[model samples]
Target chain A: MSFLPQLAFVLILGVAGYILSKRIKFLRRNIFLGKAETRNDHTDDRWKTMALVAFGQQKMFKRIIPALLHLLIYVGFVVINLEVLEFILDGILGTHRLFAPFLGGVYTAAMNMFEFLAVAVLFSCVVFLTRRYVTKVERFQKPEMKGWPALDATLILVIEIILMIAVLTMNATDQILAERGADHYLALGPLFFSGLIRPLFEGMSLEALHFIERFAWWFHIVGILAFAVYVTYSKHLHIFLAFPNTWYSNLKPKGEMVNMPEVTNEVNMMLGIPTEAASNPSAEIGRFGAKDINDLSWINVMNAYSCTECGRCTSECPANLTGKKLSPRKIMMDVRDRAEEVGKSIDAGGPGLEDGKSLLGDYITKEELNACTSCNACVEACPVNIDPLSIILQMRRYVAMEESGTPAQWNAMFQNMETSFSPWKFSPSDRFNWAEKVKEEEM
Target chain B: MSENYKVPTMAEMAGKGETPEVLFWVGCAGSFDERYKAVTQAFVKILNKVGVSFAVLGPEEACTGDPARRAGNEFLFQMQAVANIQVMNGYEVKKVVTACPHCFNTIKNEYPALGGNYEVIHHSQFLQQLINEGKVTLKGGGEFKGKKITFHDSCYLGRANNVYEAPREVIKALDVELVEMKRCKTKGLCCGAGGAQMFKEPEPGKKDINVERTEEALATGATTIAVGCPFCLTMMTDGVKNKEREADVKVYDLAEMIAKDMGI
Candidate 1:
């Protein structure tokens, strides 16, 4: 297994994989380097989350076809890991099948399973591409989607399809060699192609085929490793990130806002939105709300990176669906882009680490925040449980509390909330007046 | 037919804690909005029928302070909370109940921090129990068949307080056919009325959310939109009316529907 060529290949992949993984982790960690939104007991719902999120994909099914495609790809992605291993083992271990002994005899079953999955996933990826490029889901139509990530995804898809087909060919060759007593224990779809190779084997047989198989074996092994390394850096990072994210999602009610600091006392505790906490975050003495990514909690940052970009949240968002200024996906992405800017600044020691402008500035326009009805449909439909409502409410609180800035009607409502104890400014004395009019049997 | 319901102000009691058989906090919507009168009357009627001797402190009950607090007027919300606690101490009211979901949330979830703690129950919950216990009966009325209807689950009563079944139970008890909206129960849509938005103009959505909701109900072809909260009833009624389907659809509070079925 320590052959010079194989070692060199693995070493290349290992280092490249390590670098990209660390860089993304670094970017994700620093985006919002504050506290988490209350840790939860994962052990309690781990199985439930797995059942619902991993297998059931209950959230994804909100949109039928895409959900089905995603499920197939997810399962295929998991099952195909075996093929990659089979390639490596056949190339380096000098065998066409896994040699775990007891596990070896089942290679026919196992290889067929992997091959079947590869076909399914390939088809799934096709449907996914159509959904993304042809159908062009609204979640992916953000102004930014025309940029790098979309291009990267298209390139990756091409590579995956080509790589999988090549490996499938190599699998066919393995079947031919194995049937001729060349030692591969697999024979399923591999058998059909292997049967074709039988004619060549009929006259001058195993030795020539072994040499051909050896070279094909090396190409398949290296190709897989290269793709594996590329995924760590590409848009495919969510492939690794989604599981951990699903585990740590905010576990509270969608309408229930987080408990914030009591900037002013005696006004009782501010329940829903803050009306007067911090004003100008750009100010030197400012204790203002989040103007950018820096002020958000670590979990909020995670929510951004944790985004699978599957677009489920944006698809379910009533605002986005109705032509509003809010695409929950875009809002999170903008926050993330700003954080990446800050990360670059930190690396260069510049004036970029969340300066004066608040989160209410252009990034999350007031129109977008106001557009939400706090209905939480997006939250319910999110595969990773990102609560877009919480972010919207925070912006609402910052605007309401510190700035006291909003439309005239909202201002009036605030005034009424102070006087009427209800937003309508109804006189408290007439509170029971409604009861006087009810004829006891009006129903 | 008429009684006083006052929310206790802290100054009235000055000091000392008192607990009564039950605290009658008349929620602002129940108190000031005459449109919600049937809900209040039905609740009172049901309470009496169940032999739960409840008293109304007409002026003693203050606002539960949910709106004020949610609207960035926390100071006012606090003052109201303190005053209610003081009044409750004076009346010796230990248990609290109200027809309004807003009042239920403020009293049960928000009051403990300000020393205004008591066992609180929404009237929908209480009345549902009464109906279940056979204390409240429908008389001189048979099962009147109507078009299918959907129930609008209020945020507070449904998700916040986990009181999803009671209102639906009341609706099911009626012989009218029922259909469900795409979003119901935990995933129910808000009427653009919670979080003090009731007093303010909505945030200018492309589609008026209530209308969107009413249309969703209309899509189900339900003749009536049954609701438990006064705000939901008011907003949805206005929403249905604005869609020019006012005659086609009517929003009825759970109490009004229940009281109608029973010849009280």
Candidate 2:
């Protein structure tokens, strides 16, 4: 009967691991739905970017208050995992404080550190909840964050708070049990925060205290495992994706848009320049730009998934600030939503990519694409280097080339450019007309 | 201006088997936009005064296809790019300098993929280099000494190419107090003219981006607002006009300020 608890623990671990691996496979398949593009150059730069931007949380410092608050939670999350490692081992072996006797004093010191971080994490989570609810930070209150996005953020914070409480309660009860000379409850020195809460449990029967301690331990471990699975479906995926996303970040000057080599080949043929052996003469020409999620590069799709819905991109977007439809945050969210929709359909063997919906028209609108100034503010503002502007431009290409849907003014400018080599219909021969003013001033 | 201040053309120079130190790519706005023509003239005067051999591409120069690319017409953009590359390569042009950030960015960054590569420099960076070389000198803070000026960063020149310091350096050389807007450098606001927005009316918005940006510049309380890119020159000039502060607040390109300071 004692081994039944170990069997249950093993079953739980097996189930959680299976679900997590399945979800990871789903994520990988969905991200690879995008077109292939090489992002593996500049190995040294990629590592440094991943280290500084993702690991160091460098860009978060752009806003000091949040950066400090976030750092506490981030450090706590990393440090407390060590305590979790002991919890896992104890649960699997049906032993208490598995590392306590092995390391002696070091175990007590580490417990104290974890306890302090737990309090810090608890405190930061409350402040974050307050920012999202009470004070209502502007970025978190955008139209794109109205429903699930807002709830997801709140849920994660609340979950962390409960998990921290569970940790402290378990520690406080275990301390009481140890003082009462109970078996399996080691008397590791007092943990500062948890010790303060030990008084409430002092009067309980040893059996009741043991029940609460075991319940809290199970609650904490199970909560952590559930969180690991839940993170894949939430914006909290940034905890993992930020590393790979930043590693493959665009390294060229911000102004340099990716060149379309296919367009280059076509233009070369039209200009009668000896082109590299033409793509099979009978092969069908591909669509000019992204009409659906798959038309974008894999990195762009990954960027969509990696977004943490922070709304930093939207807040910094000039188009959004000026009341245009182009919220870059919304663009990323739309891509991710469409990707999820198509990915699920493919999983169900439903008509995928032919479901009469597309990323351009159904998810994101032409108004949003048109409103972008191609300014890199949104790109600069993203903490993980998500390039919504690239997606915007690609969709704009679809509208212009596939549907001939550019605004009337742009088409006029295009005609002028073709006829006179300028956006205005001034003669090319008079290109140096401004120099006449120089001569006139000289006279 | 002296009669000796004649702008040479690449065609004429090439006919004589001569190559200038740099090819001055006078962009569409610098050629046709009436307000921006003054900027072109001022930069030319500075280049002439410095004795830098520079020639314009004249009729051979076409649009750099930046607008088409940003507007999402890749075919049109590459068509224009191929035509321009053929002409420049034909002339063996090696270096290019431009006063328009759009042209500078497109030629410097985008052209290499299409077989057109040249050492491209924005006029702001080029002017800064000239000042550092002592080829251009300010005489006792020539007309606007100790006056308050704010340098507006062009999105393409500053954020796009990371050339924030050069224009500011040139402005400080005028001995003017360079006050900065709340948004400057990497955080600089766009002038509502990039991405071919200059050719079309802005989408429905509560206010124009230029007005918002101009409000920030005016809040700095700088009397003179100096800019480097021609698109910025036109947008900010109109913005000052929109606020009806044209008389009290003047928007001048960096080259115009330097030319006035040198008495050229």
Tell me the tens digit of each residue's lDDT in model 1 across B1-264: 534332233333333343335555667667767677667776665554455656676655667666555554444556676677766755656788887888787777766665667788877777687778887765524433555879988877876667888887777777677788998886677776776667666654467667777878888888889888888988898888888988767888877777667644
lDDT against true structure, model 1: 0.65
Instruction: Note the B-chain TM-score for every model.
Output: 0.87, 0.98
Q: Please list all clashing residue pairs in model 2, or write none if there are none.
A: none
Please give the DockQ score of every candidate, comma-separated. 0.30, 0.71
True contacts kept of each: 0.24, 0.68
Under CAPRI classification, how is model 2 graded?
medium
- Minimal lDDT window, size 10, model 1 chain A: A273-282
Residue A134 lDDT in model 1? Answer: 95
- When summed lDDT is taken over every stretch of 10 residues in candidate 2 chain A, the lowest stretch is A276-285
Q: How far out, in Å, is residue B88 in model 1?
A: 5.3
